[model samples]
Target chain A: MNALSLRNLRKIYNNGFEALKGIDLDVEAGDFFALLGPNGAGKSTAIGIISSLVNESSGSVSIFGHDLRRERAKAKSCIGLVPQEVNFNQFDTVKSILLNQAGYYGLSRKLALQRTEYCLKQMDLWDKRDTVSRRLSGGMKRRVMIARALVHAPKLLILDEPTAGVDIEIRRSMWQMMQEVNQQGTTIILTTHYLEEAESLCRNIAIINHGKIVENSDMASLLARLHVEHFVLDLARPIAAAPVLEGCQIERVTDKTLSVAVPKEHSLNKLFSQLTAQNIEVTSLKNKTNRLEQLFMDLIDSNPIGSKATGNK
Target chain B: MNYSIAFRTIVTKEIFRFIRIWPQTLLPPAITTALYFLIFGKLIGDRIGTISGASYMDYIVPGIILMSVISHSYANVVSSFYSTKFQRNIEELLVAPIPNWVILGGYVSGGIIRGLLVGIVVTLISLLFTDITVNNIAIALSIAVLTATVFSLAGFINAILAESFDDISIIPNFVLTPLSYLGGVFYSVNMLPSIWQNISMGNPILYMINAFRYGLIGVTDVDIQMTFIITGGFIITLTLFSLYLLHKGIGIKN
Candidate 1:
């Protein structure tokens, strides 16, 4: 069964601002799904509706086959949301926050305490359990939120930009922890602007722009759809001019570095053979941009008006 | 869903929040109550003499006690709930599986507890200046809870409409304090002209104070039965209104 399903979800703010036009999505159980969008692209609004934090204008939502409006308790019980911003009492201790969140989900006191301990330890916050939340570092606070969200052992986890302000090491650690949770058979839905993070962690992705879904496909299939990819190659010898190759574009970025754009239909062997004929040796090679990033940029460029709606705002 | 656990958790957290900052939450009201007794109950009572066959200090004790209950209950819910909104922590409860009534009841429970706690403290302080007597202990406690519940609901509405910290304080400073002080905490409304006394009857705090006073001193400027009816009606109305606001996702939602 699908872990979460939304049908024709719509949200119009009081000021006549339509945050979500109509969003229909489904994330199957045990899948790591990515919801990608630019700022104000209705990603947060959709999350808010699923979590019952915002009132929907019209639509239907279900989690594990329980209607969000009619069977709200069951629907909400199946989901855990870690919002884009830190949203816990700063004066509260980390342990108390987790314990309270567990309590909110109807966990018994004994169970709440046990889950609090387990989550705190898992997030590496056991040592800081008694510390006031505001006194902790940014990353520590983020982990505390994650631990709180996991305290109830929810079936579906939704993280909206959870690693936005976190440092690289902390981001990787969070990603690892999320992967561990996902592996434990919990369906995970993540929203982030970092395409690389989505590429590495999410198996399927949906890109939203101007409150509409622009792309939705499995990660591999979507990446494969990227026809053109740019590569930066380090040359063994300095070249005075850019290399010339049939059916390929090349530019000399620096005396020792060369940039090349190769289409998916073309082979790297053909480009290498042509370079070898010119007596040019390639020492190192790397993608100028990841496949997902390249695809996201191309999609955004193609739909400039929709992208601008999220961009300028 | 386990409603009891959800309610208990929210109540426990709220109590902890106030206890963790006792000097700020619990101490100031105690000090304020003491000063009110010193100036209005003692120094002023000595000059005013008898009011309704008892010492002025004794007559105003119930009013003063009700005042503390009103202010603390209103203040607790307003500051705590608004702070949650300001800090964006209200989403914790919003996203939880708990029912809207459970959330409202939990917050009102906290406010009632704080109001009663402060009332007890002030009542104990009033003992130093005046001999206290309760004609109906049940009535007195019930009235206190009812009054606290009413003010807590009012405060919740204020917090909902408040856009900033300044907005939270505006109604409390300009409206609540003025109404409470003039609600016959220090003087019986009967002492005023008939026209003024009729106008004083419009102040809801007057009925709450008089009902509490009737419970304690067995005398009230307003009819005791009508006082109970008004207070009970307000409680029911506000409870429904507050729940409606919460269910509508007003103020707290995106």
Candidate 2:
């Protein structure tokens, strides 16, 4: 069964801006999904509509078999949305915020308290539960939001840029916690600008641009489409010119840096051998950009203005 | 869907919100009410003597209590709802499975609670200055609750239409304060010239104060029956309007 299904979802704002234009999407139960898009690419708008924070102009959204329009309560109850912004009452304590959110979902007081404690512990915020939300660090606040969303234990969780600003350490910890949650059988839908995070965690991915989905496929399949990968190599010594190598294009970025694009059919070993033949010593190498980021950019750039691309696996 | 829990949560949060900041929410009104008794009841009432067979201080007590109910109720909802909107925490409720009516009921109940609590506090202060006797306990209680409900709903409407902090204060400062004063809190409408007395009848607060005054001191300028009609009319109209605003997601949602 699908945890979420969006059929022809559309949203046109009051200011005559069309944020979403007839997009359809589905995430199977217990799947870890990524909904990636650039800024103002209608990612948040779509999530807003799904979460019932924004009214849809037209379309249908269903969660766990409950139609959003006709069975709003059931649909909403099935979703636990961690919005990109920090939206909980700042004056409220951490425990109170989670308990209140649980109560909003109709959990009994005793049950809410229990869930609040469990979620706080899961988020590593048990000690800070009595502190006001505004007093917490930014990363802790983000964790509180995730914990609050989980207090109700909804089947599908929607996280909108849940780690946009946190330090790397906290981001990785959140990723681990999310994986644990997914492993426990809760479907997760994450929207983020960090392609590496999506590439690493999401099994299925969807890239939206200009209010439409441009690419929707499983992670490996999407990455498989990349015929070439770009890597940046740092030289042990300064080089004045680019190296000429077969099946690879190399450009001199700086005195000691070389930018190379190696086709998938050509192994890095052959490129290195060619460079070695030219007496170029390599020190370290890294991808010029995240692998998935390259493909996402390609997909976004390939579609011209006001044009649509087939968004199917 | 556990509407009971949702409703309870919103109400509890609202109550806690005000109570958590007792210095801001509950203190000012008590001090202000005491000052009103000291100045108006003691200083001014002593000179005015009496109106409508009751001591001037005693007659003003009911109006003073009701005024507290009206302003506090309106202030509670307006400030609370507008703060939620301003801070964007209203998304917490918007994304929930709670129905619009439940949301409306929860906030309004919070306002009513604050209004009545302040009313109780003011009444206690009123006792400090003047001897009070209830002409009809049921009528007094009924009018207090009804008046609180009416203002709470009105406050909800104001919060929905308000765009800024200034917008929220405009109605209470410009409209509510003028109307409450002109509602005859310190003076009976009978004291006014015939034309002015007729003009005072146009203010809704006039009827509420008089109805409450009649309940507390058995002295009223307007007919008790008319009070119920006007108060009930305001309640129904404001309730529907508030629910309409919520259903449309005005001010709070995009």
Candidate 3:
């Protein structure tokens, strides 16, 4: 069964701001689904509804075949939500916060302790268990929030902007931890602006813009359909013109730098051959890491009149 | 612990949050109440004589102590929950799978614990200042605790509706402080005229203060039974409404 299903989800604010407009999505068990969007693209509102935090104006949601409205207790029991904002009882320690989350689910004291220990240790917060949460560093606090969400071991984990304010190293480690968790059969539905992270970690992806899904498909398929491959070239000498290479769209500037796009069916050897033939001595060449930032930008700009997407007023 | 994992977590967080700031939360109130006893009870005892059968010091102790209980309890939850909203931490609980009742109870528990702890300390301090006797231990202790919990929940709800820091101060300054003073904290309701006497009954704190007064002096201007009933009603009603708002995710999830 699908771990989560949203059918015609809609949310209209009191001021008649249509935050989410008839959205539909299904996340199967054990699948890593990345929901991508720019700020204020109705991502938080959608998360609010799915987590039973927001009252949907219309439509229905179900988890493990349980309806959000009807069998809400059963539906919610299987889901955990980590919102984009870093929020925890700052006065309490990491252990107590996890323990409290466990208590909310009605876990026994011994079990809550056991689970709290496991989560804190996994998040590298076990040593700080005795320290008040407010005393932890930004990255450590974010990790505590993650442990709080995972205390109950819910089957469906929804992480919204999980690495928003963390440093790169912590972000990478957190990603690796989430990757391992996702590999362990708990479906992770993530929302982030980090397109490269999504491209690498998620098997499926959805991009939302201006309160609507602009693109949604398998990760590999989405990248494949972009239909353009880009490369960076370092020249021994600077040049100021777009280079001419067979089966490649070349953009070159300055003393020695070159950026080129080759068709997927064509090989870079053609460019090397052309570069050597033209005596445009190549110093170094490299492929950009798997980053879908361009694709995300394209998704947003796809609608020419999508309005200025302003974040939190 | 299963059902209460979330509950215990929220309560512990709330307690730890306040406890970590003892000077700001607990200690000030204890000191203030002590000053009230020294300044009001000692300085003026020679003139006022005694209102009840006990000494004036004994007479005013219950009111001062009850006043502290109501104010601190109400302030703890109000500030704690409002800070959560301001810092955006309440979003964490709003997104959790826990039931509304558990969330409400957990927070209420924190307020009660703080209020009662402060109340206990204040009561012990009051003893050194005067010789006081207990008339009804169970009713007095229960009312003190219940009144604190009820006001804490009400304060939390009000915090949610408030838009700013000024909004938070308006209630405690304009509403709660006035009601508590008029609630017979320093004076008996019988001392008031008929109209004001009836008006005093409407202030829930009167019941609590007067009940505590009765517990200490075996004297009450209002019936202790009615006091119990009022405190009970407020608890049930405030608690249920808070739960309903929580279930509906009022001012948050909604």
Interface DockQ per candidate:
0.87, 0.87, 0.55
**Top TM-score hit:** 2
Model 1 residue B116 lDDT? 94
Each candidate's iRMS in angstroms? 0.7, 0.7, 2.7
Q: Tell me the tens digit of each residue's lDDT in model 3 across A122-147.
A: 99889999997888888898788788
lDDT of 1 by residue, B156-241 (tens): 88887788999989988999899998898888898999999999999988888888888998778887778789888998999888
Quote the lDDT for B58 in model 1: 90
lDDT of the candidates, in the order given: 0.89, 0.92, 0.81
Candidate 2's displacement at residue A128, Å, is 0.5
The TM-score measured for candidate 3 stands at 0.90
Error of 1 at B49 (Å): 1.3
Deviation of model 2 at A149, angstroms: 0.8
Question: What is residue A209's positional error in candidate 3, in angstroms?
Answer: 2.0
TM-score of chain A of each: 0.95, 0.95, 0.92
lDDT of 3: 0.81
Error of 3 at A82 (Å): 2.9
Per-residue lDDT tens digits for candidate 3, residues B50-104, read: 6866677888888888888888888888888888888777766665666777777
Evaluate candidate 3 and give its CAPRI docking class based on DockQ.
medium
